[model samples]
Target: MSSTQVLNHSPFRLEGDFISQLLTNIRTRSISWTSFVKAGCLSNENMSVLKSITSVNDQEDPLSRVDVLIKDIPTYSKVLFDSILELSNNNTKNLDLTKILLVILYDGLTYINSELFESTITDEFFKISKGNPYPPFIEILNSTTSNSNNDDENNQDNFIISILTAHILTSLLTTVPAQQPASSLDLVSLLFKYIQINLITSNKLQYRFLGIQLLKELLSIKSFRNIYISHTEYLDSLINIMLDKNIELQMRYLSIYCLWTLTFDSKTSQLLTTNAKYSEIIPSMFKFANDAVKEKVVRLSISILINFLNTSINSTNKNEIIKKFLLTNGLTIIKNLIERKWSDDELKEDLNSLYELLNDSIKSLTNFDEYENEIKTKHLLWSPCHKNTEFWYDNIDKFKENNWKLLKSLVSLLSDSSIGDSNLTQLYINQSIICYDLSMIIKVAPEVIKIINTMGTKTQIMTLMNSPNSNVKYEALRTTQLLVANSL
Candidate 1:
């Protein structure tokens, strides 16, 4: 335990007070001067000499040393495991005792890697993400094959890196562990249980991503459908996490994605219609879709709408929710993205998601007509932002400003999915008519009207009034005018 003992021993030295000291310090939010280059020298085999002092007997528990490491960091076992990774990688190209050590070390590391394979540090993961730099598997596929000289013979480690988690479980089937069908559903049940017990209810971000990625994989399975469906309240807990609070973009991004996956879930979608617990969660799905940086959110919105539409096709509750989404003219917003003149990478990606959604929406409208009491939705004629522009007036801000005009262009383009749907009038009426069907509660729903009226102000409102597809702005203007008109 002395400094001489620590310095004189090889990486195989056990009871090196050096590592034991630094780990004790890390918990206080300060890292010690001891480095990975220094710590990488400790040997797991030598550490096996550690003992349980409570026994007072002359015997030692073989795992007592490693147990101390894990007990000290039950929350961040991954960080402890990482020390082994640094050591193994340093000796990967050594081709001698080092290679032998790397091989022996690989099996235990593999086991640790497998068990924690798809787990996460929840939302704080984004902080870990920005500090630690590593590209995802898909990005690596587009580049060269060899990423490192580690256990992989042909850059297979590159293939193993997942954006969701660096998942590495497999059966030599070339399929990642979680993707191999119902067999991995146990993985689903297990991870969700850990997440529910820990990260789901926490204010912390660490390990929050583990839950997000695991749930995402679960949804991909048809068998685990009931698992998520029955846990409606828990899923809602996951959904309602506030976005602005998450400083980590990727974690926030994954949380939004998890909600999207939940809403699109067939059973989860049906349950929301009947379960009182989920009505808030179900409608709130639009929060992500309505945000400013919304390509991921919009795509998920389309999925939520599609699931809701399909559930409606089979049952009821179509009017209460479906009508708002369809009329929010969110569909038209995406369509315009596709038809617009811009050709940037970000725009193209967003446009692709928009097209895919419109494609699915058209399919739903076409195929769901067999149901009774089907309220026919219409085609879209996006009224440009100017006109009798009265809605703009209520929205506030200068119409002449370039930013205001640019906002109009971004949401108004037509998409590929918009190309063939013939019910333009029906879709337009759905937004203009059904959405405002809340006309009776306009006084009570001031917040609703304010959100709808956010884009422009009074002068623009007059411009929107005389605008070509003026009905929406006009209807809104008439509704506002009617309150005082009726008061007199």
Candidate 2:
């Protein structure tokens, strides 16, 4: 699993009505605001049932819980959301109030319904669609007065504002439907400007990750993608980070995912292929694909190339760009990548898809006459394996290499708990593809089978054979058949 995937899914749902209830209960019972605010929602034992309700994973009762939260939360109306928003902006500069308000707004907005958001919440939180709603917090952050004793508190305040702002932006992107006018490109740009200034520009790595997290979310929406159509600065920043080896691994991976997101737009793709600076860095991305540390980055790097190729399919200058890509050794790189041991069938599918695209394009460009000659001469052979082997020798063998290290890398991936089960499924599917490919390769080159056995590859293959997924089992069986057939 990639860094982008890990951060995209929200771990907990925040209930608006529950928030309102806590405030109302505090007021009715004459509790002190400071004490209640300090206690926070987590400290209330009496609200355990409500907390439990919120704790129930949406996956367990998707229709019931999610629907109820969406429908019931709006009944409290904008009063709760507005109150929290106003408190966050209050001039008193009480750190406690700011903290509590930030907590409420961040949690509630993260999971609110879009219709509710557009109709009742936008004006209050954003001060009419065109205004800067975060000035007060930003003032505190930009202030030069740094007390040595309170430095930790000040840092905490900045971190809260950063996280809270990101969650607000993410909630808007999440709830606002693509067709709604509230999700205007201008509004997205305004919020992104804050993100760029406050989070992306910060020297702190935490702020960079948070900013990129919001970038990943916004680009998930097609309407929001228009914000980057003419604006290449975001693309430039993400690329710079991806190329920086000094940054944390997660930050670099998120940058790669952000670039992948932009490829969905033609303008971004055009800039990448036609723009001088971007075009220069295109080859370096392929090197990142072959990096030994993580398979996800390699998968993402190839996926980015695929997007670039897809974008070039129709352009008048398609051949020119294709020639550039080939000069970068794109064909040889992908062929060797395919030979790498994979833990996910989907990634293998991606590798195959890229190979197919590259192969078909190259054939269209170079083999038009050969194809015609084959038809005229009726020279095609009936044997499947023989022709396939010959094709590998002619085109693929020039890049031919063993993947003993790929096997070791994949085995290490099985123990990774960082990525969710969905990613694990992809890893399983990828392993299946590698097994199937190895089986076919062993048929033509029997010598490689000894290498596979020596690497203790059979143990891993048998483990895949026992997998519950039918697709994985079928591939495992086919691989076993090839291995046994060669030995006999």
Candidate 3:
């Protein structure tokens, strides 16, 4: 049948005969069939199957077919789900059929009322997860093929099914009431069992990534972390993966987020910092901070370190941790990052926050000048050979080129005095220097004010309007006027 004919029929009129034809096509492997049925079209059976299949097939856009079905005919979703589950369970060796069911199930499960489905099959789901094949849900549906030749296909099928199953299970658990116990078998435990099995043992990065991604989702569930924290291995796996330089960069990036979530809990935070096995994880994170090649990875690593610094621990313990962070050359690295200008606009605030935190941590243990002066020497802020520096030296002609770099560096240092025991005189002096640089850039640069405004140095400059120093105050007022006038 043509798609036009299918699409033209009214929803109320599209049931009996058309459904039988569609089912017949599906059973007979018809080229145009979008779904299947096992027997004669009893009116109710045909209606249920027809509604779902037609919902999927009549829509011109395949991408949105299932979404329409869920939104418009949600009451019929279970009927659609039951048909696939029954077909797959009834015929085990048909890999082709199983794959078809998987795709349909993936779509439906993604948008269906998960709590309704979970309640109906909670016991069966728990039973399915209990044995040799890790994803028992798929195993119960498919009997093993005896031929050894299809092992590769079977393994591939199993991996996809396993990942799909994890997603389905996680979704189902979403609507479960907080007061209700997950299942006869704990759903979180089942999830972690598979996560650890796949994450720690698999050599493949894809599998490991899938496992970490699942863990990230689980972190959204209120009680999921309590279960996760109980199992030390889960925590260990995350830290180890994050620190392993040999692992894929994306995988390591995901692990950093997962670890960051764990640090929210006091117990998890202590475990991460105090665990002997994870000694290298924290240090390696600082190393990541020093390397700006991967902007996201560096930012996330720095964020996790900030969380550690914010984690509540005894003063002596905190000092020891700071000392460990210092040993990683964290102080030097933060200094280096502060000196180099970043091109990505998104990274500017995050980079500033990292520098501020590391600098604060250092000062808490000792004086600020020792680290502050050392950081200043690293930046070529005063160099006459501007071409040799990162930005704003020789490009007297290109205000676009030099203006941003000069502004960021000035703001970075200006923010330095804002962090700790402020020397007003030093800050005024610092503010005077930055305002001087700002005034000079405005004279030569065309688009510079917007960048300065967008970079958020404008507000800091506005604060300087009240400065005690007349030169600093005059420069601040002039810079503010220029920025506001440029915007208009």
Top of the candidates by TM-score: 3
Residue pairs with clashing backbones, model 3 = 386-393
All candidates: TM-score: 0.37, 0.52, 0.53
The runs of at least 3 residues in candidate 3 whose Cα sits more than 4 Å from the true structure, single-residue gaps closed, are: 1-64, 67-71, 84-96, 108-153, 175-181, 292-296, 338-488
Better of 1 and 3 by TM-score: 3
User: Residue-wise lDDT of candidate 1 within 392-436, one digit each (tens)?
Assistant: 443333322564452243223211134226345543443354223
Shift in Å, residue 164, candidate 2: 0.4
Cα RMSD, each candidate: 19.5, 17.3, 20.0
Residue 229, candidate 3: Cα error in Å is: 2.6
Local distance difference test scores for all models = 0.40, 0.56, 0.56
Clashing pairs in 2: 343-427, 343-431, 344-426, 344-427, 344-429, 344-430, 345-429, 345-430
User: What does candidate 2's lDDT look like per residue over 1-488, in tens digits?
Assistant: 12221223343232234333433332233223435335452223323322332344442322322333344444332334434444445444455444444444444443334443344343444434334344433333333122212347566555554455456545555554443454345557765776676667667766676777777777777777777655667667777667776887777787888788888776678778776556445676678787647988887887787777678747665665665555566777888889999997888998887677667677555332232222222221122322355644453332234554433433344333432242566565455555665665566566777777887776777777888878778888888878777878
Better of 1 and 2 by TM-score: 2
Q: Evaluate model 2: give its TM-score.
A: 0.52
Worst 10 residues of 3 by lDDT: 5-14
Candidate 2 off by > 4 Å: 1-79, 108-159, 292-295, 313-316, 343-346, 356-488
